[model samples]
Target: MINISLKLAILAAGESVSLFYKEQLEYFFGDAVAITAYSIENGSVFSPKNEDVYLVTTVSFECNEDILKYIPKDKHIIIGDVTFKNSTINRLKEFPINTKALLVNSSPKMASETITLLYKKGVNNIQFFPYYPNSMETYSDIDIAITPGETRYIPNQITNILDIQNRVLDRNTLIEIATTIGCDYLLDTKRFTTYFDEISNGGIGIETLIEKNSILRQQISTITKSEGIGVIEFDVNEKIQSCNNLALNLLDEDRSNLLFKVVQNIVLKEGVQSSKKTKNIFQTIYKNKKEEQINLLFIPIIKNDNVAYTYCLIRKNKDMKRENEIEKEYLKRGHYSRYTFSDIITEDTRLIKTKEMAKKMAKMNAAILITGESGTGKELFAHSIHNASERRELPFVALNCAALNESILESELFGYEEGAFTGAKKGGKIGLFEIAHNGTIFLDEIEGMSQTLQLKLLRVLQEKEIIRVGGDKLISIDVRVIAATNENILSLVKEKKFRIDLYYRLNALPINILPLRERIGDLEILINYFKKNLDLNFIFTEKAKKLMFQYNWPGNIRELKNCMEYFCCLNERIIETTMLPEYIKENIDLKEDKNQSTDFLLILEILNILKKSEKNEKGIGRSYILKCLKETNFEISEAIIRRLLQDMNKKGYIISTVGRGGSKITQLGKEMANNK
Candidate 1:
């Protein structure tokens, strides 16, 4: 006999047939396998200890990508018994043409894939409704209902209901078993005969198999010996057949008293009954003799369409306290931003319109992509939109994609199962997506996200779900995604750095914020707003104001706020032009020639020409500037004059609109011209 001891994790095994499949696999492998089953609905996964461990997924077609995220393709064993049968297609065909049907499955993704499959298989006449667990009441329009198991709800309009049973053990079981066990020739005559005999001729029951196999017993004992965990096994009649030492100690009952006792007489009796009825995993809290709450998980094991045995996994509630603390820490870090639309202090008409459009967009649930230069308040807009939306009461989680490396970013966004990697948390962590459920997730610097993560994010946006790292379960989330980027996302897509599909999905409601220099009209208002918030009594001199307006604010509002804070820290009642930051002064002076007097003359002459053009109701172009320079008896080249005009525009002496509109003199420009 092969000495291979396999630890198999079965994912999405909540269905009764899936449970039956699990029992069959266990029975066929006998004592050589230790199985841990998980339901995708529960959003929990069992972490395998080593690379030698195997993973099997009975999840629906849509969840294949999700399962693949956690398990390597080589390590994943595809059990053929988990799939639905062609009878489902035949049942759909029985319906009249143009019939409206509701396809109910474990998840929305599953239902969607099933509908697509039906259509591909020539059942296009029926309109299918993807299952929405929370919106079952709205399913009254459903004409027919098709489900993988018994229908949870039947609307009056649903005249026909079809329960499509998934095959428990397909003919490919031998091939699956051989592949799963790493055996090369289990299909050979001798090996196939032995395997067939073990499965067909009164296979050993799970309890008997464990009792007879000392190695299996030792493995179970070793696992159950972990501190703070309790395990118990019961027969099909709900009689406790075996209880680990941890369970005995935790329940405050010895084996003599607990063994052979009906499980309904013990703790979690109601949960056991519920799990048996539904054939689904259930959890409940049980109070021990010490009045301490214990978390109990009831999992039923099915065999030949009946419950063969059930396992009760128990742990002290206190064991979860640490995990809760970790979750709370992440929650604290994901607190909602207090900003609102009213907080965006701006007088610029274009910016006001943009804000209004954004407010309207917020009322809808589509994804929004905000594009702007850095520090242009893209995140501010994201916060304001979230606060104004219907989901304002929920969290506004913001993460900078560029701030972390790919590995850390993936873990923070999607989270991970326990032992997903080195130094992982004990019970795994809840990602920002889970934390921001029913709210908004602002992904700033989204262009910086890796291509791999972009594809994952695209799936989440499309499917409205996420699967944790090292976990096969799909967690549904209802979050409004607001992705922001300083770079041009379309350009990145063209460059093949970002996924084009994701770009289009996120760009459904695009909002572009103008840079500070383009919105100079808002500068004075922003300055006063920052000053009032800083509680500064200082007043800016006319020269100081002119100097600020003249310098191009490359850092936008964020830099302006910093400048205001620095001025307040100086404690000066009156702020002068010379008191500005050295860099600002240097930048201003750099625009002029080394000869300050000559530079001043050049600026004055250009302002004069622009002011004349304003009087003439005609903007001054480069050709006009050359003519004015020649008339002023200045021997400057056309290039020199053009450069001077550009410099004067940046200095706020002129406003140059795009196209053939040319440059026009501002009121500040007039003041400088008259003063000179």
Candidate 2:
């Protein structure tokens, strides 16, 4: 234990470097030490403070002796043990095999030492050229520069400078300080262990991954007797180090062929290529020789965010497969298309023509984007398109992007490694893309996907491969994507909420289905079909037919189906104008007092604004309207504005056009605003 509170000083080349180390030193020693910092860049190196101990930045640090000249003689000094932050080492590993980056530092020796530190941390992937101040080396061809918080020394040509945010002191320096300050007993505390763990593995905080290997073996032995899980341990080279009998059983491999062998799976390709690329725990699906589907969980024994050893746990898949109603013996997994082009019953030429276009598009392998309002049967069209395609015999997986949140949606769509993040699945799960390989994946409400996910999907479209959430292995897929969105995706792209390149990739074969209101010619046939499908012996009267024709189906086909269900529940054999649902009836009823309603009032205000802006080429947009409404303490959403504009256009009060034309107030709209 320290008899007195010790004072220490840190000297570095720059202010940022000095302050960073100063804070680190203070945090390391806590209240037991008083620390001061000085830097040559800030001209504070000669402040002339007598200190009990001096910590030079690094062993390779120049002027280490000169910096001490300002201090009192015979002071206990330690050259700091510096290392790259664990985060920097992980980032360095992400660079391609031949990626070149300039490693900038304060001095030539410091640069070389830092590069060595990176190599020691297992960041040997990138080719890092050392760059220090006034070094006559031109790295003009290199686009990226890496530095340990030394950004000012980076050359002007390098635009993408990744600052690893200052070199941090290694556990050795902390121990050296502890011993020097008579506080060596602090080494036994959890706080010190936590710091040590962070310096080792970026705060994941396990002293040795060898403990995990032992724990995994114990788990394999105990777990097989109970849970019947199969586990295999593999090294960075993808060579099998250990495998239990349960694993051999799952793999259907004989003992003579399994033990101490390089692993080669007939299915799932071991779910991972090289364990060296794997940094986090992930899972994939594979099948054994018996055709029994199994889940392979690649649990990485990580050190400093790099996989040292992978513990693969195999569990049986719960989904069963068998031949179904198809003539060919198809693997029935409930991921098959339920509709063909014949199922899309429509009398309208535009719809029939659109269906024909989609059917022709199905023959091709390019991506498809289906756009329509909610209840416009976009998903129905997607299913029909897939069934019409050659992949109809294969899986047709569908995912509603809007239904799940970002995390759940990501895992559901792309699949994830077990323990990818907090609350991740235990055994891990297969993604839809993996399940839909050699078939079609229908992403419903594609607009609802986050921009981050959009980029991933774009990559999948381009590369025809997917990386599971928290996984590194590229799983190749041959899938035809059919993405549907109820929202105007182009508007979202213009708003920067969606990626434009993703839009083009998906919109390769576009299908814009008309809403029920626009395609009313097919409404009667659809109505009767729905009634017959529900086994309802119902008929609508002439007055009811008029109301149905006049009233806009806001909920579209889904709302109409529910409306039919409502009538069926009412025990009505005949549905009249008075028997309609409130939502449908409200349109007719609300019209009488429409002038008094707040929505109508807002509509009137918008009409006046549009009337004024009618002379403009672009007219007026939702933003200007929102801005105007906000000025008057009115709260409104863009969706509500869109609905209002759509209703106004339908009523002939406004003429709305796509793109830059925006919406223009009609003569009727001017008269309506005058009424207000």
Candidate 3:
């Protein structure tokens, strides 16, 4: 109520000019500062009633004793690096290439400044000559004239005019102002950190660095915004500065009632004494109006090398415990790349070369397109490339493009703000892109992304920024995208199914993984690796290997893994061609007693399925085998099973019970069945 905000007064040559600069300051600083303007040419008077103030005036306004006596004199800064509207650039672009134009402003200094800014903004196509009121020089050859909302200064002879509207202070000018007013701490806030990047045509001189508490404060903001925690900041004198939504709820007080209120008088418990301004954490327990216990973690922090602020993170007791457990569980399953180039177990010359090339591409920052059949380990290569890159230490987020529908996938990839959609999370969610900042995002099945999503993704690739699903804020991210697709993207593009621009954007660096069949050299090595990894004791006989090599593994490495798993399940030591899966044996000639092997497998399958009968010492009858074989799809009859049993009996693998008495597996047959 004391009006303690900072103040800045402006003195321009005319009333309109003075109000113009004052408007810029008001629009930027908002209520953070109080602004006033007086025109020197109009002989207007500026009387200061408040002792706390700052003055911004040209030498033309002679300083009266009353003004200096009222406010203290500080250092002076000449504002220069001002920025204009981006629409200004767009309007200038409409002019013919290399067209000559005149830039008219209120004064010669302002005119030259505007022209210089235009050139810096890459509007070199248009030649601009500086013009102002009462200038001795004139440009008759220039038919086009541009003004920064100072059209009155333009000569009437110029019919074609482009008004850039008005110029405003750029980031650098605001930084200087904030620093001058001892409000530089605001620059580290989320508002100023993303201030220039958010606004339209917000000029250069972005904040180069942050103070000591910037990162810690950012961490605080992130933690505070999370589901469980609620953060509140207060000044050294116990005056509340800020409180989050959860905090307001937990305190059972509205924000308007809590902010700027003293803790001891209104809300704080007797045990919660005024904390001294130092680096310390104060833990306390309090019962809210709902009769539920809440935990408070008060941390005193020094900002700008001064003990002016402290933070209190509050959470309900039960929620805090649950949140801790969830956090621990999250730590167990983290976002990390599990594979590197060394993990790619490949002996094929082509695959080896592909890995080497991919490793080379990893050092640079660009979008990568991996084309291969499904299960070819495109994600493996993606992980390896990220680990080999400079951003290896950061997160590695993998999302399947085909798994989610359009809206869900968009929300997951780019996140959404609170109240963005129905059932949106309270604080919204941090997207995979934000989580993968300064790292890599492996988008599996990129071709499966809808056309609309592809266009949005193209914008991200071009601008290195993303607007959340239902948010206007532009979040700048430094993520390296590694997109993979099993489909023929070029074909899809030609068919108008996929966007060509997005394809080209993603295909900046391309890697095509050969399917397992084309690189059969790696088959044996991969088999061994999968066997060892799966802890399988089976040995692939040369016949089985031949059959496997003959097969075209359309499913690629993942299919090969499945094949190994199948052998593991069979629990067979001698994996002959007949033991191979039916799919693998397709179109292959097993010529060597293929019938005998088949019969052998049938008997094994019968014995394994039925095992030893309970009431009888012998096994189930041959008719049962015939029944199972027929049920499972085979044209064989009971006579075939009888002959197979007789041959097996000759080998002493089973007790010969050809009559009504069922035949049982002998010890030798059991040994083979058990894979001994």
Candidate 2 deviant stretches above 4 angstroms: 1-333, 590-676
Q: Judging by TM-score against the true structure, name the best candidate.
A: 3
Candidate 1 regions exceeding 4 Å error are: 1-331, 590-676
Pick the winner on lDDT between candidates 2 and 3.
Answer: 2
Clashing pairs in 3: none
Instruction: List RMSD in Å for every model shown.
Output: 23.7, 26.7, 23.0
Task: Give the Cα lDDT of each candidate.
Answer: 0.69, 0.73, 0.69
lDDT of 2: 0.73
TM-score of 2: 0.41
Worst 10 residues of 3 by lDDT: 203-212
Residues 1-676 of candidate 3 have per-residue lDDT tens digits of 4353566666554577668877766665667777777665565534543423444332222222232333344434232235665666776777778788888987755564456556545565676667887988778788888887889888989998877776655554566576666666566666665655433342211111212233234334445546766878777777788889998888777788778888753336322343453354466777888888887766665556665566777878765453454344334548779999998998876777678668867865657889999898999999999999867877888999999999999998998889999999997766777777667889999988999999888777767799887789887767789999989986797698997556656775668898888888888889889888999776554457777888888889999999899988987887877678887766564456767567656867765644545246556787776777788787797788788788778877777664688777776676557762
| Angstrom error at residue 643, model 2 | 44
| Descending-TM-score candidate ranking | 3, 1, 2
Tens digits of per-residue lDDT, candidate 2, 135-192, equal: 8989779999998878989999889989887778876567667767767657767777
| Candidate 1 lDDT tens digits, 218-277 | 223333555666888776677888888888777777688778888645455676677778
1 or 2: which has the higher TM-score?
A: 1
Error of 2 at 443 (Å): 0.7
Off-target runs (Cα >4 Å) in candidate 3 are 1-333, 586-595, 598-676
TM-scores of the models, in the given order? 0.43, 0.41, 0.44
Specify the poorest-scoring 10-residue window by lDDT in model 2.
Answer: 202-211
